[model samples]
Target: MNRWMRPLVWAALLGTSVAGAQGIELLPGTPRPLDIRAASPCTFVTVMNRGTTPATLEGEWVNGVNSVPVAFDAPAVPMCEAAGTALTPIQPQRARTVRVKVNSAALGTLLGRRSVLEGHLVLRAAQGGPAILTPLAVEKPSLLGRTGVQRLLWPFVLACLFILGVALRVRRALGQEMFAAEWAPEKSWGSNLALITGLITTVGGVTKIAESVTPLVTLTGVVFTLLGLAAPLLYRATLHSLAAHPDRQAGPVWGYLLASLLTLWGAFGGLITLGALLDSLANRLSGTSDDLLGTLVMVLTFLIVLAVIVFSWQRLVQNIDEQLVAAPKRHRQSALL
Candidate 1:
């Protein structure tokens, strides 16, 4: 992905000589300087080309001396670190939305404290002509403001309650006569481990999002982030154990098929999560380098799991009619003869 970035693109966008109107205007009325906020941080200002000529509007976010980071993967917006962000040529009298992202962390660092970004969006014209300087300001609200606590607590609380409900249901199911021989509470080590690790990861994720609170929160996030890396594997093991239980032999083909589907879903989670974790770790360790190892691993895992799901489903379908036919013929054939 880094190879896609050329130094020339950055130079061309950032090195424009002059600054003026440039025949393009911010639509829905020009935004007030201090009215802009970073709580939502992403602003979608419509750029209208009032001139007869088709014009290109490229955005460069800068705080006089420093550049703010723009996330390229933001939905509905196209941004690149090298080329900056640009909109398609708007013909005369046409409008298009231009997304401007303010980096709060960079803003904080610039001001030497937690604060919002007060910057300008440098909109450049074709052939390195004059630029339109649009003022931008960010607003950083308090950490505990407006449903902040609710957002943190509800998802975590609901997830925990759901997990507890599942544990109780499993316990009840195991006590039933049909599943008594198949499920042993003593042998549920894999499920237990997944439960513990998943809960820790969930808690860590919640607190990590609320990281402005304390150093302990950040440390918890780092520790569980590493520990959570094993979740997919443990989850897979639990699903595999449940699906391959001896009692499944007595159930219908649909039941087995459902188990196979569950197994496939579990495998997907395991493979994708593991690959993401590996990619993140590799990126952190390597620093400014990129590789395809994680992608390759994920692709291979997908193919293997897909094949397993397909084969199992096909086998189940083939056996369905055979089982149905044999059932009626067992005692009826003797009676008819």
Candidate 2:
């Protein structure tokens, strides 16, 4: 739900595309970069020349930023060398295998480190029509590389950011309403609807990503499913139950916020598989075994949070009811005077 989980989900989703990687051949009619991602030291790109006349291919590793030189030998590896493409051009209607070897030692430095190096491999014809800008992201063997994520991943992230921002704003508005003791149906009603929606969904998918944490965390999902449904049930029982308690504290705002975040993290694509776990306190400083003596800690965490929500709302309602009951007595006293 916090730092580790975000990238963990990001990488988990990206990693799925890696298994789909298969042999590819480039055609001459349209120019597209042979994007590659691999944990291995060597990456190969197949280039096919379907054009007339001989064409020569040249490559350069334009280290956009000079720091991490993972693409060090990108230029040296001559692809389509079956026909001596190094010295001679490939005749028309032929193919070549472009092997790009990464400095594993340099890339190895990124393992256990939470970082990635990005660089471009520029592939072009010596006659120079258009260059294929092959973007290469070299990192830990288990994380994302060669992910053709430009089409879908970025847009999804932007949408998630927008949703997260809105959730936080709603939580803030609810808090402000309770603090000011000026809850208005016109003003706060929309936020309460948002809260009800979040609470229900968050519980349904709370432990969906439990396997990534511990296989045992899944029981919480079942429990939260019922727990999360309660908000909706309350509405069904009394359409105005929530409306009556306008001056109510937002229970476990942070917990609810994180639950909302985790729901998205688990529901969206899990692109990466963590080949190695980063050593941090989240793993109890042991970052070791994947065995399952597991339990539902995330559930317990949410249980406590939801309990606070119910408890605070009940207390607020009782206080408000007492004031309403006493209001008539005070009015009668003023009339008698």
Best by lDDT: 1
Best by TM-score: 1
Clashes of 1: 2
Candidate 1, superposed: residue stretches over 4 Å from native: 1-99, 102-129, 132-250, 318-337
What is the total number of backbone clashes in candidate 2? 13
TM-score of each: 0.33, 0.26
lDDT of each: 0.40, 0.35
What TM-score quantifies how close candidate 1 is to the native fold?
A: 0.33
CA error at residue 237 for candidate 1, angstroms: 21
Give the per-residue lDDT of model 2 (tens digit) for 1-337: 5633443343343332211122122433322222222334545666756567777665554444432332212234444222222335656777765555555555444433223345554555667554554455543432322233421243236335744554544543323221112223343322343344334333423433222232212232232233333333332222222254564322223333333333332222111111111111123333422222111222333354344334433433332222232131121110000
Candidate 1 clashing pairs? 37-139, 38-139
lDDT by residue for model 1 over 223-311, one digit each (tens)? 33333334333323333222545433233333323333333333333333333333334434444113355344445545754564455
Q: lDDT score, residue 74, model 2?
A: 21
